[model samples]
Target: MDGEYEIKKAYASILESDFERAIEWFERAVRLDPDNAAYHYKLSVTYARSNKLGKAIEHARTAANLHPDNESYSYHAGTLEAKQLLQDAEKYIDGHTQPHLAVDLLKQALLLDPLLIEAYLLLAVAYGELEEFGPALQAAKDAVKLDPQHVEANRLFEQYREKLKRYLRS
Candidate 1:
């Protein structure tokens, strides 16, 4: 009964656009029903809407773990993790000091979301910088396959094609 009341308050707070209150109520509901994956997922969504990504990821992960068969929960957790990995990869790229680190991070991101075109594009660029032409070209090709009209992917694909041609000729 208490859990139901908390869920009702949480829903009402969401309708009112009071995300902070919604989170508070949702947190209470989750505590009252720790095994309730739905409660955890709802808390995760509220945290996401509030732009508290860390908390969102945590709760989303909890929900997904509790209900591994729930595709929606798992998908949300994967997406959140991928986004965080992408951000870390960008930081490594910006530093210009660890292309390998960025590549590793981006690889993890792509593993989580294979169709992430941006991750493929960035991965291709990173591989090119490392002179791993085969994988680089493949990644570029993958990006183009995922989104043919993606301007940067197309550019990268052409660039790699030229690079391979020159290498073979030499």
Candidate 2:
């Protein structure tokens, strides 16, 4: 079959949630046309869904390098990096030293794409974890602004608003 056919097959496999088959077909497509950033991006998403963060990051970075202005690629890279950072933060939650770094990663993710609602919520939580109520309130507000219907963001925003008001009153 043609490269395009193989690429289409890979996409179909991905849509079907057959990540292993999608990876194989996408790899073949990449081998056939390594310059195609779309193939790399799709492969990166497949790898991410398969829990292969390292490979997902590698391919997402490659896609971003190939197409610097592609917001989707950059967003994918930022999201993957944020996931890794969040995992690391969870590992150090009891140590009191890693939440700051986690907040930094979540901030970077939001910087890359301000529309990332989950990142905003996570950043707010991380800020709250670090006792940075002011920043937490800001992050929560941003999340609520981006996704008014997001339950967590709304809840966090209300919670932080009340807390900040009390803190200021005292």
Candidate 3:
């Protein structure tokens, strides 16, 4: 069958909420049209919906690489990358003894998605764990900049600022 036919089948499967079948059809479409960015993007979306982030990131990157001018493709790829990095950062944070590693990952994620308020908030937490109050205050401020109405960001910023002031006084 043609790639178009496969895509139609994939969409139909999605309408039926049969994600596994949709994934199968999308994979077939990708195989048939390896160079088609749209096919790769669709496959990437499907993979993400199925909670297969690794494959989703692979296809998203491929689609963006194949069509550099397509802002939608690049944006999706960057967001996915940022999300994966945030997850890794969260794992480090959960360890409680690896705040430095989480800080690094969170920084990378923020670079990719500067508007990611969650990353900034998590970064503030990591910096606080490391007793780096200055950076923690800055991260909290950034989060507040991204979302002025975020209560947690405001609270963290105030808390870190106080810590930094106390450190300076000593």
Candidate 4:
């Protein structure tokens, strides 16, 4: 079948919320026209909807590289990369096994998506876990700077600030 026909099938599958079929059809389209940035972008979106973030990021990066002038494609690729990093950070943070690793991941995520308020919040928690109260307070403050009205960020900022003050006194 032609790549265009495969793309159409993928779109129909997506409209029906059959992400598995959409992914299959999009994969076929990508295989048939490997250089087609549009096909890669569509496949990336389908994979993302299916919660296959690794696959989504792979295709998104390909699409962005193939069509560098498409700001949307580049933006999507960066966003997906940031989300993947954030998710990885959350895994470490949730397990409470490696705050240092989590901090590194959160910093990378924030570099890619500076507006990710959650990354800052998580960074604060990771720093606090390491007994780095000053950095924790700064991370919390960064979160608050991003969204001054965020109740949790504001609360965390106050908590970290107090911790830092006590650490300084001691």
Q: lDDT of all predictions, in order shown?
A: 0.89, 0.82, 0.94, 0.92
Write one digit per residue (lDDT tens) for candidate 4, span 24-120: 9999999999999999999998889888999999999999999999999998998889889999999898999999999999989888889889899
Best by lDDT: 3
For model 3 the TM-score comes to 0.89
Error of 3 at 39 (Å): 0.8
Q: Tens digit of lDDT per residue, candidate 1, span 106-142?
A: 9999889887788898888888888777788999999
Candidate 3 residue runs with Cα over 4 Å from true position: none
lDDT of 2 at 1: 38
**Which portions of model 2 miss their true places by more than 4 Å?**
69-79, 82-97
TM-score of each: 0.82, 0.78, 0.89, 0.88
lDDT of 2 by residue, 45-152 (tens): 889989999999999999999999999898889878777765665554446667787787776666656676777787777788887889999999998898789899
Q: How do the residues 1-170 of candidate 3 rate in per-residue lDDT, one tens digit apiece?
A: 45999999999999999999999999999999899999999999999999999999999999999999999999999988998999999988888979999999998998788888899999999999999999999999999988899999999999999999999999
Considering summed lDDT, which 10 consecutive residues are worst modelled in model 1?
90-99
Give the range where candidate 3 is weakest over 10 consecutive residues by summed lDDT.
107-116
Error of 4 at 125 (Å): 0.6
Instruction: State which candidate, 2 or 3, has the greater lDDT.
Output: 3
Root-mean-square deviation of candidate 2: 2.9
The backbone clash count of each candidate, in order, is 0, 0, 0, 0
**What is candidate 4's local distance difference test score?**
0.92
